[model samples]
Target: MLSDISGGLELRQADAVARALMTDDLLRAGRMIGQFCQGCGGAIGAVRLAMFPSTTRCSICAGSKLLAKGH
Candidate 1:
């Protein structure tokens, strides 16, 4: 859809933009919710939460999880 609208954009760029827009919508909808990190027991900041609204895990925990997934 975004690629169709953004005719000049590369597929990767369009995908990124589409993802960002969708994520922004998700964050706006979930802004009031205080997402907690299960691993560190830390509160995820608004900026981080806005960037990643679908997950309860904070960036630090998410990064470690990703690292572990590679193993």
Candidate 2:
């Protein structure tokens, strides 16, 4: 029983760490996306920006780039 409890605790701790790392990745992605848009002279919407937090540009910029590349 004690071992089981310890195992459960460890699992929870690992999950928490994973969630924190995911959040950090998201923030970094958002900053990069924002910078990309800035370079392209486009703007990201506040709501979408906040939601993604790590995206560099809004959907429009991404779509434009994709369309330009014929992708």
Candidate 3:
């Protein structure tokens, strides 16, 4: 039973670490793109689409781009 408890704790810790790393990566990507949204350096818009989405642009930017292309 103790082992099970410890395993759950470890899993939670791992999840926290993973989230931190992903946040760092997102910030790095946002910096490279040079955009901003809700003060997350543009990550807020892009993160919803997951890890750069289909382009370097954030969701809002991607939508605008699509519109411009008449898609």
Best by TM-score: 1
> Per-residue lDDT for 6-71 in model 1, tens only?
788555677878788998988877755576777677888788877877777777877896645753
Candidate 3 structure quality by residue, lDDT tens digits, 1-71: 24645676544788767777889998898667754542223654545546754454456655675544743
In model 3, which regions exceed 4 Å deviation? 1-11, 35-71
Ranking by TM-score: 1, 2, 3
lDDT of 2 by residue, 1-71 (tens): 24645676554778767777889999899866654454365677777777877776666865676655743
lDDT of each: 0.73, 0.66, 0.58
- How close is every model to the real structure, measured as TM-score? 0.42, 0.34, 0.34
How do the candidates rank by lDDT, highest first? 1, 2, 3
Worst 10 residues of 2 by lDDT: 32-41
Q: What is the lDDT for 70 in model 2?
A: 49
User: Where in model 1 is the C-alpha error above 4 Å?
Assistant: 1-33, 65-71
How far does residue 27 in candidate 2 sit from its true spot (Å)?
0.4
Model 3 CA lDDT for position 21 = 89
